[model samples]
Target chain A: MAEMYSTPHEILYYEADVTGKLSLPMIFNLVVLSSTKQSVDLGVGPKFTHENGVGWIILQEDMKINRRPVDGEQVILQTMAKEFNPFFAKRLYRILDQAGNVLVDVDAFYTMVDMEKRKVARIPQAMVDAYQADQVKRIPRLAEPTKFEEGMEADQVQEYAVRFSDIDSNQHVNNSKYPDWMQDVLGADFITSHEPTAVNIKYEQEVRLGEYVRSEVKIVGNTTLHQIWANGTLSAEAEITWTEL
Target chain B: MAEMYSTPHEILYYEADVTGKLSLPMIFNLVVLSSTKQSVDLGVGPKFTHENGVGWIILQEDMKINRRPVDGEQVILQTMAKEFNPFFAKRLYRILDQAGNVLVDVDAFYTMVDMEKRKVARIPQAMVDAYQADQVKRIPRLAEPTKFEEGMEADQVQEYAVRFSDIDSNQHVNNSKYPDWMQDVLGADFITSHEPTAVNIKYEQEVRLGEYVRSEVKIVGNTTLHQIWANGTLSAEAEITWTEL
Candidate 1:
């Protein structure tokens, strides 16, 4: 089995909101950071991907936030590769406070893709062997995100021009940015009064640089449904449930 | 003399751009983080500000980027409290790669402000004493950012509504987010082709929640002039010089 990788991070001022708790988007960014660190440690990082002409693309992620650490608090982020199949890999993440109290848990699914062809590629046995990832016949599944219905009207629509800062090394918008678009569509007042308790996101298409993406948000009770469209195609969809603060 | 506080940071994938080099805004955020760490170490962090009902507000910052570090690279961020007078404090930052090569240098000025009144306040003598800040009477001054001429038309004017992600614990937009706005106004093509060599920003007013701030960009040769307006009043201005990559 692959060893769990843990990284310590201090909650910086920029990472926290007015309530002093870590923001959801920042938490997602930290998850990505920790995952990348684990890949580097497992010898499947950017260097390996660049050499092999293959890259890992996240397909879906679901996270439950039990508690949001505040600024100046030091927390540990631990991740482990659960299973790797022919085309998909599953990973789990746990975030703990200084006292080792679990603050958040996340499950992420990824697939190997050919960088040039942009098609799903088989996960090489050698790579999986290198990680010594757990071999599980049945991987636990997260709740599948529902797509926005055809011709469904949105309560609010917001437009964002993809900027240089939004694109990652893959020349596409970073997955962590999708939450920002969703949060922005909810506006400031709604966000300030409500705190996200859970989030589920499924990335369908890549958002390229210079693209103008539209985020459509539909609010039902405490849950917000988000659909992102670029060039008339749905790029991503997400569901976020919030608690009144 | 207070010993310089140095923090080690690994360049995460999210901090770097498509070129694998750290983005300018991320670099600035690192500087802020380092500075905050130093303040905490010196017993003048957020807790102190909360207790005293006063906080440091950055007035202006100037930075020179020598070399941008790439993802997975380990670097050291060092900061020093240079000087503190009655109203203002000066700080300096140096970012060095693992090889001890300086990657960037920055200087920033700040003043204490009453959180409730939102007006400048005198720097308490006890706080300065606690920091053990340098007593240099002649604090080095950064180049003053030239304000955009009144009634001058901009080449591009873009509006961005302040979102949940933009507001920090201070209930105002984080200073680092301003650069992203400026870069967004320039679009992806300009940023991908040019690298910023130097930046000088002066914050004149605070941007509140739900405000639609307009960023006006005027390009002249290698230098770009930026003005951010809210409610028809100039909130901030910046000057950035670029080098062709």
Candidate 2:
């Protein structure tokens, strides 16, 4: 497929993670925004979402981080549908550096929902047709995380109750807000002065309304990592390396 | 000089105005984030900021908005130093769409400060050398605001006391937090359901600690459109169009 449509964006400081590269949650949010625009350009913009009072809700996500891209590095994010069923759709994505080197790849699953009922619904034919028609060329699917690696238990752990402001467009705790779990574990002093050099994270599950997730941080020599889990299932995990300023 | 580096960002829903395009404050925040990174990559980064016990502060800004870019549209933001004087450094920036169309151009002055004394100070030699030597090319001088915009008048406008969370990394109001000013002007119901479309705003001045500024918003034509103003002077004037649903 031709480029069809493309938008540009600049990375900001708040968007940067430990490695001083953009954080995974931020990357996820961007994927969502870009995909929404692509949908609109395909004439599906806000039809089912606004007119029918329905929207896509991310039920699950499996992502892997190969390498961290530094702050101020220009890159492109492209999205296209991989497959769709009556209830769910699988989408593929790639993050590339300015020279077109693949930085990260993601495969996401989404379900349609009735906003008022807050229940999953069948995918609208019109919506699927819109994305399928505008589907950009697909990139290879991202590496999915293996079962939890041994010795991965956190070295330090902290907990936080979700605040009202933490919710995102979907009215759920934003995927990116999970990083605050790590930041809280690192404590204010460490974060205020030190910059993370790189970070790799995966969102295996999500923390829902009014619930608190424990953010655990582990140290292995110079590298510090963190993760959040609810009940026994992993929610998100991240590795951060800090440098003295 | 050749471009040393640039970063790509995807627009988020929270960043969008009612028009579904990104808002001026959101774009401004993007520039601030990019400029900070430029300073860092130039080797000035946060080293000089810490050494001086002060940080970069945006003193005044004058910007022009030609067109608005919608949410999910990737728009490249480019930044460069225009001139470095004794106490202040002038920077110029441009926001471009995929075809490299300029959506907005900004010219503003930033000053180094003594955080302890709350006073402006000359640019340190080390800082100047760091930015000048970096490969990001400098731009030509910029145009001044065409009209005479006044600073806030002491009385007559509605007043708001700043909140603790309002202070951002630099200890000032997180630039984006000001849009809540418009929300303050409207009833709660309008904000919960209606979405904002297009907005035009200018940051004429800054509000500091212990200072309260007045807010004024005027409805134009329909309740959906508003002309918002702050303080006696036009701290910022915005046109917000809302979408029901």
Residues A157-199 of candidate 2: C-alpha lDDT, one tens digit per residue: 7665553334555666676566556655665456646655444
Instruction: Give the winner by lDDT.
Output: 1
Model 2, span B1-245: residue lDDT tens = 22434555566785765445665457667767667777777777766687778777764455556676875678777777766766777777777788888777767767788878878776787776665623223433433323322442312233454433334545455555455565445543455565554343445455543344555555443332222233444555444555565
Q: Which residue ranges in model 1 land beyond 4 Å of their true spot?
A: A134-141, A146-148, B134-141
| TM-scores, one per candidate | 0.94, 0.54
Model 1, span A1-245: residue lDDT tens: 88788999888777887778888888888987887787777787778887888888999989898899998889999988889878889988889998999898999999999999999988777678877897666666678876567588998998887777789999899897899899888887788799888899999899998788999999889999899999999998998989998
Computed on alpha carbons, the lDDT of every model, listed in order, comes to: 0.86, 0.59
Pairs with steric clashes in candidate 1: none
Best candidate, DockQ:
1
Give the docking tier of candidate 1: medium
Candidate 2: residue A35 lDDT (0-100): 75
Query: At residue B60, what lDDT does model 1 achieve?
Result: 92
Q: Native contacts recovered, in order, as a fraction for each? A: 0.87, 0.08
